[model samples]
Target: MGGKSRALPPTRGTLIERLRDPATAPAAYEALVAAYWKPVYAQLRRRLGLGNEDAKDLTQAFFTHVVERGSLARYDRERARFRTWLSRLLESFAANEHARSQAQKRGGGTAHVSIDPESADHRLGASAPVAADEVVESFEREWRRALFEDALEAFRARCVELGKPQRFDLLLRADVTEVPPDGSRPSYRTLATEFGLELTQVTNELHAARRELRACVLDALRARCVDEDDFAHERRALEGSDREIER
Candidate 1:
């Protein structure tokens, strides 16, 4: 029998480590913004009681500050979770910026940061009322949602690369949503008929696709951890919710 295959290296690294490396910092910062901007924007809007436009500008400015300051590189993994650290950082930045905006108004000078309101709305939806105490919870929720979305996209791309697009679609239809698009749920038999495969084949393909998705998600989460313990903690936090893979 052949020995077990070695696990592949993670596709990326923790944001802090990436920010420290000049070669990887640019791409890593882009990924960080894509993964985090929504939550950060939403949190800012809610916590600061700012209008949509103001929130958007501040969010853009925050990312600019991060890039200029190499803020992620300053994160100490032992001190706090990245999300916690970021929430505090954003709060401080928002307060300081708000004060600066007031000072600028007094001096009659204007400052602006370009942000796409439509994009922000599409990602975060209509602004809902959130209690001040719940801001942290809201940020964590959005962060997890974004992380899962990234993982799902990565899984889809991997499926395409592996020539298993049908398998990926089948799994999404079967496990992620209602297949019939109506009141009734579809069964293995129904899926087999729809996909023109044997019932056993349908079952096998879905199983494989789900396994691959789990691996992809794990790899994503692993990239955010600074050490084995951090990775394990994040894995539990991710899998601890209602979004566990269906058997």
Candidate 2:
């Protein structure tokens, strides 16, 4: 998602700003919700290993539990990485799925969900020796995907607000985001012709869009890591985990 778009990338300053006052800005929340969705869904998928429909239901339930139980509101940066804290919460829910099922059968008041603990045990390495490779498929991996999607959503919204909706779409199509490259990408002139915008106007729009996008992306990344240095470390950890699974 961190692709070249002839615009400056996000900086650390803005990331700190958004993290400090997320409720004050819709853009910040958008970036956040986008970022965490993946990790959460990934956790649910691994835990349930259910049919698509069941997985979707449990995913929704997990998110609902997180929000309703004040998960985000009570988050503590000092106590744990976001992933670790959430993993615990997921384990709680999974371990109690049977109890919840009974509650449902009795029609009592509780947000019942079939959250099985065996999957959680597997993820947490509580069971007999399963290769570390087997654990990479857990929800932690989705953190990256969610963060990128949130930033992209914010970028798109910023473009529309600035009356350059089409140009925003062009940014996605013109650049292959999966493998970002260095150097000047396509110019406004090319985008203008392709999207039928005046050259001068495209330049202005691109400039604004790029600036906001950089901020959004960086903030998304920052919210999910320890710091800039930790960001690289977390990525390395992820790489090692993936490689382990491959082997």
Candidate 3:
């Protein structure tokens, strides 16, 4: 470690319980919506053939319904992953065209978090409408991307706090940044020259940075899970790698 050590970010060990607890449910719902809203919006657009405004309104309304109805409190982690359960709920919500219309007319209330369409819409871009099954397939990919993005942001902020932002820059260039067309990364010697460090120092810094990033990613990933088993399963599926999600 080349800088002051910091504790890992918060993890929600009792996510299920917190969602069920009235006192904690608001905050829990906020975190849940923030994590899943993009995928929900995307699925609504693709699976239901809704335009951006309709999808955005429906997304906001769906989460509002969930929060008002205590829908997440009914989630049984043993039955399905949180995302799968939420997807089912979204499908039900989207199926009710009358309800969707009403929600849109009323201008869907804020659902414990702001539903920003601009960023999600930009990323979704203009693609031919995908099938319902394809929407489901893409949902998992979107969720995985969100996980790593949250992790990377947390890691970057932590590096700043530790006065080792260069460590993150080094890691980003060496690993996170796009590689050459031939799939080659900058050599360690090259990185050393760029960062003004010895090769040994570069190696040590990268190792430590990677370890910290893994911790940050784990924190983000685990916070969305209901229990230890769920976290373990997800960690295994991620395969202990830091590869960027292919859009």
Candidate 4:
């Protein structure tokens, strides 16, 4: 995904480098929080069996602790992917918080990330509790969901900037929306009619949108990586995910 097409604008440095720098830390931290807070909150709710309010409070506290304590600086790319490292860090934080028997006040932490527990909870629906063996699996699923969501938003903004908002609309309808009960996607002919475009134009615009979305997703994934090797591993994992989606 990070290979050629750029989804996000260029930043001053890698995620870790920016986080460690006083000048760029705020923006970097904001981006980090936006990307992972949902996944963290989901894990806290599902994996730890915490109530909604508790999950939200602990999510805020965990991120604040990470920022204030400089704990992420200890992450070693050689030891694990940043996703794995962060998940482990969350596990440790939650365990300690439980032991202390006091949840930190929500929105009271130094971290600048926004916590939207209601939205996360809504997305999770009223599913049964996640099994212990599936905690990591569920967390990674939320992570991928968050990654694509951010990329889709970025892609939409890019489309609007290009003065082709209809392109995003078509992509959203044809690909992003849930399939029909019959498992059928809207046909290009149907989209062409709905958007008042030639069938060929529909095809071309969708191709461009998908291409851009792929680039955007890669850029998002790359931002979280520590190095080229880390990016390579993650890109492979993402490609595997893509294949699964295709299947």
Candidate 5:
């Protein structure tokens, strides 16, 4: 509880039915949008480097387009993260930077909510500090990092089931207090103290936890592609936590 839990709490039936039946399920659409909107917008602003106005518009239009355009089906969780594939789509959108405006003009074509383009632009452009490119980069390149996080979540849930969720909590909250000049990773000592464990025990648990998480992430990414080679690259890309594809 030190910081906000960022992972989505598991919701079994409602979200699945909604994702599966977006056409008729009003509740589903809202649920999907609620879960994804921030991440989508976060990708736009933090990785793609869009201005606040453009990012906001992009976020709205992205979800609208996904629902209407029958693109969500393309998101196979097995092969890629919802985030990585999303990053690619976002890149395509960003490459055609002017398209969001035009897409907004066209609207959802189904009496979808009529969002004001100018208002979105104003909101997106509200913050000038973060560049579009930075956000975009974060989206694509975070495959490994995101996967690690997902793995961590999976591990946490697994531990919770085993009645020891707090045991590995510290790894979930790993943070850099001081940057090593050479960019070396922090030692297990810091993590041990934070989680209240002996150094040796902490090291072993960290290894098990990270390994499990890595495996979980790779498993998720593996299900996304038709080609094994592409999947391998995606897994490898996560190693350096760098962008796998150039936009």
Candidate 6:
């Protein structure tokens, strides 16, 4: 099974190494915050029952703590997934903040970490409250959603680079979304007629777009995994029993 699996990229270790290096820390930290802040904010809102303003404040504070305190240096890739490690760190930070009555009232200690309260509110509105025992589950769910969103953005940029923005739009409209909303699928013939193309062209472009999106998703997942084994585990977790990749 292992022999059939694709070789995992070294992005995860490379990112960690960059975070640990003073020369590269600033840029790496920014990337980290961009990649993760949404899930962290969502987790805070769902787990601790925080409002949008407080969640945004705490999200910024968490990243600020990571940068200023060099807390990411304590990450042990051998011990756990980076996601788990960061989640634990966030939980501890929230606990400590709650312990300080003044800090709790003030929202958070860091002012430099800016998050969009409106975006957080929109996300919160889309979901029901998660049970306390299911906070980790909630965090993982949000993380996967964020990861796929990042992949979709990457796919969109690639489509623009390849001069096929229309193809991407078609793929999203026809395959990704349920615009019909009654479980009724759109036909390639109809899409081809709408776009003034042959049915085969619509089919081929949709296939290509799907393949690119899948690759982008895998690339995003590779960036977050601590190692090859961790990558496999996360891929399984994300893809479930439809495991196209071997163990």
Off by over 4 Å in 3: 1-13, 45-56, 95-124, 240-247
Which lDDT tens digits does candidate 5 get at residues 48-84?
4455555666677887887788777677766764555
Q: RMSDs, each prediction?
A: 8.2, 11.2, 8.0, 7.2, 8.4, 7.5
Compose the digit string of candidate 3's lDDT tens values, residues 1-247: 0111223335454667777778887777776666666667767666655556666777788889987887866777779877778777776776685465557768794333333686356436645565555555667766777677778889999999999999999999999899769878899999999999999999999999999999988888787776788777778778844356567
What TM-score goes with each of the models?
Answer: 0.70, 0.47, 0.74, 0.76, 0.51, 0.75
Off by over 4 Å in 4: 1-10, 49-53, 98-126, 241-247
lDDT of 2: 0.57
Candidate with best lDDT: 4
Query: What is the RMSD of candidate 3?
Result: 8.0
Clashing pairs in 1: none
Q: Counting only residues 3 or more apart in sequence or on different chains, how many pairs clash (N, Cα, C under 3 Å) in candidate 6?
A: 0
Candidate 1: deviation at residue 125, Å?
5.6
In angstroms, give how far residue 100 of model 1 lies from its true place. 6.3
- Winner of 4 and 5 under TM-score: 4
lDDT by residue for model 6 over 109-128, one digit each (tens)?
54343336764665566456
Q: Write the per-residue lDDT of candidate 4 for residues 1-247, one digit (tens) a residue.
A: 1111223435656788888889988888876776677788777766555656666677778889999997988888878888888877877776675544433345344534334686456435535666656666777888898788778888888898999899899999998889868878889999998999999999999999999999989988876675677778889898875244543
Estimate, for each residue in 15-86, the C-alpha lDDT of model 1 and write its tens digit. Answer: 566767899877767666665676777777766556666676778789888779867668788898777778
Residue pairs with colliding backbones in model 6 are none
| lDDT assessment of candidate 6 | 0.73
C-alpha lDDT values of all predictions = 0.71, 0.57, 0.73, 0.76, 0.57, 0.73
| Residue 133 alpha-carbon offset, candidate 3, angstroms | 1.1
Candidate 2 worst ten-residue window by lDDT? 1-10
Q: Model 4 scores what on Cα lDDT?
A: 0.76
> Can you tell me which runs of candidate 1 are displaced by over 4 Å?
1-14, 21-24, 45-57, 70-74, 95-125, 178-185, 241-247
Which residue runs of candidate 5 sit more than 4 Å off their true CA positions? 1-39, 46-60, 63-89, 92-138, 142-145, 173-196, 223-227, 240-247
Candidate 2 lDDT, tens digit per residue, 117-214?
75444445422322234443454555666656677877887778878777677767556344346656676687788778788877776666677776
Q: Between prediction 3 and prediction 5, which has the larger lDDT?
A: 3
